[model samples]
Target chain A: MPMHSPTDTPLFGSWPRAYAVVLGALLLEIAFFYGLMHWFA
Target chain B: MSSLDWWILGGTIALLVLYGLYKSRGKQSFDDYTLAGQSLPWYHVGMSVMATQASAITFLSAPGQGFSDGMRFVQFYFGLPLAMVVLSITFVPIFHRLRVYTAYEFLENRFDGRVRSLTAGLFLLQRALSTGVSIYAPSIILSTILGWNIYWTNLIMGGIVLFYSVSGGTKAISYTHLTQMLIVTVAMFIAGFLTVHKLPTDMGFTDALRVAGKAGRLNLIDTTFDVKSRYNLWSGLIGGFFLQLSYFGTDQSQVGRYLTGETIKQSRIGLLMNGLLKVPMQFLILLVGVLVFVFYQFHESPVFFNKQEVERLNAGPLAGEFQVLNRQHQGLSAQRRAAVLNLQRATAQNNDAAAAAAGDQLDKADEALAKTHAAVSDLVKRNNPAADKNDVNYVFLRFILDYLPHGLIGLLIAMIFISSMGSIAAAYSSLASTTVVDIYRRVWPGSTHNEVVVSRWSTIGWGIFCVVVAQFTNRIGSSLIETVNILGSLFYGVILGIFCVAFYVRSIGGRATFWAAVVAEAVVFVCYYFDLMAFLWFNVVGCLLVVALAWLFTTLQLNLRPVRVADE
Candidate 1:
């Protein structure tokens, strides 16, 4: 599906992309925390 | 402030402003002004979301919380990950598809214009006041450390943020947040490590935890569903979930963070990252405080952690009594240290009885030390009526200043300022955006002819308003971090309720939701005023009340449906 314009009825058009984004963000956060705790401990 | 300190602060702020303005050089539409044209990558959005949440108060007061209360505060974030997941499934996709500038903008489309305005107003009031506290958190440190006028410090701190926010808007705020979060993470880690290094040669990190645990500092999980207790498993999961949901899902400051993402996927990812990391990040910060608590157990600490208060007591009529208490504290510290060492040895040998006996002795000594500290603090307060008697806010800063190496001290202090800058900048941006979009643009449609100048001036106006609010920020007690959270609870539930009704209860029209919200907010305030429940419960109560009331109103309206006039 083409990306919805700003004026579209709903904001996001794709759930797959949304899920992908959330997963990717979660991984990055986990990595950041692991490094942080290990570095300090 | 010292010449060097002033130079460091001034130079850092100047560079940020110049960089933001430099990058802001372009013809920008409303999308560019507010959402960075929705072009930022996932990393930028993630950092922005993190920075917006991790305010200066997190650094300034969290360690103090640990120093006094222990690691239990970490549980406050347990609900955050779940909140993130829920928002991903619910709020993110809808908001992303809506392409709204402010979260409340979507409410109007779903419900009515009145509901949108009410939600926006709640957000405006809460964000403005909370931003004031955020500005005040760092200003208090600069004022106390440098003995500068807090009024002027508030202006300087708030103004610096306003300058950049007004210049580059959301894009500038995001880029700076990325840098600030990086520095904050590294500096905090170093500070935590250095606290352990300051402990006696025989003690290690594990030893510190054991000592802190004995001292009642490592109380991480409290399963009891005590509404009065601020940090516990239930509050963290249930109450905190509601709070976080309202904050990230409804609050424009946070909504603006994810709104900067290039795609819905990117925005959801950034939020998910936040949800996943927030609890652990909070855990680590609180752990630093717990470790600091343990470190103090094996070493002689001050009778009162607030040095300024101690100095005043020494110069006052209570000087003699204070000295006597100080001497007594020293003796108690010596006994406590010996007792702690014995307990550690007994534990190492797996001698449970001996360990218990030694632990009891250490606890007795700790009690005596606490009495001495209380005496000193009381004396200090008696001498100076305006004194900050609660030294919990200063516990970690005291340790850092007295023990940390020179370069690290600068870095840690910088970390506090950087965190402060990140959150304050985000708040400033949010405030400006809300003012311009919700109030200004709404009131004066087709007045976009002077949008840029109006936006800049609105940023300046809100900056001044927040700084003014910061002036009355003193004497808010030790848990400044918790104080902000509690304050947020006051409005977040009502705001969240409006959104919940908007997203899920399509049958509830705007007027019903709007009036229901006003009543719900009043009820929350009444409960708070009468001390009917814990502050955390307000989030749950306010949200549930709004939804229930809105549903009732809608049901009533359905029954009273007006008959349409027949066409003759």
Candidate 2:
């Protein structure tokens, strides 16, 4: 097979967008966990 | 385990082995065997990747960690999503393009054979050591449940995975992972649900969380900046990032997983999927652990969860001392249970003052209970020097055996076994591929040996090696999950640093990178040996040290030639 170059992530529009979504989700999880601890505590 | 449980467990294993053999029916070449012909789609790649990392250590030890340490351990994974993002952006394209059999092959292309071998060697060592530790985890389950000797269980655990891996190669391992992950996901979810379901009808999930929170078990985040702290946000973010980066980017066990994807997009998307799901998955698992903790508060709880060790001490010459501590433990547990019930009623009535009072009593009761537990552990150790003192690994397993419904218990045990199988099989395959492609192929440059046969032999050799490693893993100081990460931290940073210099620092050459890595590893060792800082930081420190040392060494030699791997 020919050597691959950077490929688009058609699922999330593009690679950068996919990364954004994952990282964005992480930030959201951190926020959610903080909220969870506070509400439970 | 009931007959139904036995059937579920037996049927699960048989289905897995048969399914793997079925999927990998056709004859395969070295490429097909090691890389599954690089034809798998993103979902297969995604779950396959997930299954490899979700070893028995993850299932048995992580929940146990949740029980003992609370959600603070979840911070250890905060760096994971970011690392996935970084890998998706950088490593995926390069690795997919090069089409190498192992991540270490890229090192060979970028630096030279020595660097490749050294990095691969480190991966082999750490991965083998960690795999052995994980293998020992499920063996604990079998030994506890069946009263079988652990040596036999370890051998059996390692052999079962070897059977599947040798027969199906990477394709079988990945295919089996598809089913293994499905059962694991479902069983764990049901377990969490049942843990909550078993609570008194008046108490719901939120109430359980309240109880756990008041007990300091809902500590989800710690923004502490302490260097010596193990699982604060900073360590998880920075230290975890380096560890995750090295694990996904350099470790052949994981790298080999993504390499099976048909396209770079498949690999990237699959990894991104892992990033998306892993944290939530871990959170759910930890929540189950916290719920198990809550379960014990309302019900009876063990002073030490390792029943085998507890039993031995209770029946030994120290029986008298253990009985006193056990009685003390029972009284403290009753007080704690009463306090939690009061807290529960106070919360239900919206009585903050009463709730606060109850929480205070609960804390005091826990302090007494903890002291009793410590005394018991000390006595257990004194009774038998070889007994495992840290019983966190047994917390979840004991709860399942004692509390979970029977058929589900069988399924969950099967799930842990299968989870262990997925990881061990992947480790075996990676070891074989690395040994065959990086070491064997390179050493005998023009030899047209049938590599598949050699790879099979290599798998057998590694399986035995890891099983031996399992035998020696019982003495690990931390929970098995943390022990695995600690093992990874020891080498992952230096490996990632070498890759960083290769990828981004063109002015450095192979020799400088090599010596720099050697010195960086020694420094990391000293830091870990003397407890200079938490283990997670070892990744960050080792990686930075390699890059810095490589640059310094290169500049000192005045070798200003830009770094270029073979592809360029």
Candidate 3:
């Protein structure tokens, strides 16, 4: 995917990518916690 | 407290307050006072937003939550990232474009004054009451650790912030929040490290986790579909989403935080930063609590974490009975320590059977200890009918005081106090702006009252109001953070529903949406009053109820309108 619009770049290169990073981070954290839960369970 | 600790506490607070006042100097108008002239960069907006949400209750009670309830409570913020995304895509852009001081201002254009006024009113009521609770959370720290009167602590806590908030407005709040979050991050990370360090020599971090996991404190993700379960993943993701969306998207305390952003992109980035950081931050805080749980498994734990209450009960007529319970608590603590040691050894040896046996013994010992604590609590209640039965709020405070080094203890207290000030300042400013922009200015457009003067008075009025509310907060029986959230859940959903109607259901007029919100709010309250379901789900129920009722009422109106028009 295009990382940024050349004329109007913002944080994380673009708005969509920025949002994707946040949502992606949430997924990663949830996965880590889930693994911890089961590993310890 | 030691002299070194006192110096650290006093110096840190004084420095932070002076820094805020310095950074916010020379704000000229009500706009500058309320929105920091909307000139802050994304990082300032981000830190300010985080600080506003994380009140004293967060630092004081979240770890206590982790200590008692386990890692599951971290799930409650699962929906927050999703809420942030929605807000970024929709709410931020519109609020920025409209150039409204309060989020409710948009409602007037979208619907009418009544819808806007009602939403603003709901925000004011919830924010003020919760600000009182926020004040009470730090007051607990002072009253418990310093052995000061609760009333005096409440006043000091409320008044110190009031002075800055009234004078500096959003500019002061933003700078203070930046400092506050920095202190919180550094203090909590150090505390987490110290908690693990305080554990027995043989226990590695993984060993501690294994012991905690065996004790069921690591139940971080419950994928259960049960509606009544409070901290399960499903509710956290769905219900928590609505609650958070309403909170950040519509609640002026939060809206005011981001509205300080220099531009739309800045605001969105700030919120996105919060989304990315909050869950992990909360997880670490709770993990510290769990580690403290691990720490106590090795050392002797407090029967009741509120030392002041325990000392008070000790001096009472039932001192003999309390001593007997104390002896039982010591016995149970010894048994628990032994079982935990065995469990730790078994886990180290990788012997599953021995570990399971030790875990059972540990559970049994801990259960008996919990019962003994309950009996002592009952005695406390009998001695003073108004005593706070829940010690969850004091668990972390007691740990910091009893265990941490002197200077560090002061830093931690200062951290919690600063956090309380940040949120209270934000709430005070938000309340003032909503009062001025939504209620006063709109109500009396031609009045000669200076907006800045009225705004200052409004800030002071809210400060006094919240302080009064703080006086009654001792009767609240739950963990402080949960109490604040539960109070918020009562109104947030219906308010979010109104916004959803305004944003989505274009056919639904203002009157239908307004009345629907009122009726839906009543139903949500009824649900809450009866303990109908887990409080998180009330967010989902209330939001959906308003949407459905508004749509239904709109349909009825359409069906009846033509005949009335023809008659006319």
Candidate topping lDDT: 2
Local lDDT at B412 for model 2: 94
lDDT, candidates in the order shown: 0.78, 0.89, 0.88
Name the lDDT value of residue B516 in candidate 1: 82
For all candidates, state DockQ relative to the true structure.
0.10, 0.58, 0.45
Model 2: chain A TM-score against the true structure: 0.71
Per-residue error (Å), model 3, residue B34? 1.1
- Which parts of model 2 have CA positions greater than 4 angstroms off? A1-9, B558-568
In candidate 1, what are the lDDT values of residues B230-274, reduced to their tens digit? 877788778988998999998888999998988766776677678
Which of candidates 1 and 3 is the stronger one according to lDDT?
3
TM-score of chain B of each: 0.94, 0.98, 0.97
Name model 3 segments beyond 4 Å from true. A1-8, B558-568
* Model 3 lDDT tens row, B55-104: 88988899999999898999899999999999988888788877899999
lDDT of 2: 0.89
Model 1 interface DockQ: 0.10
Best candidate, TM-score: 2
How many residue pairs in model 2 have overlapping backbones? Answer: 2
Give per-model CA RMSD.
Answer: 4.8, 1.8, 3.1
Tens digit of per-residue lDDT, candidate 3, span A1-41: 21222332477776788889999999999999999987876
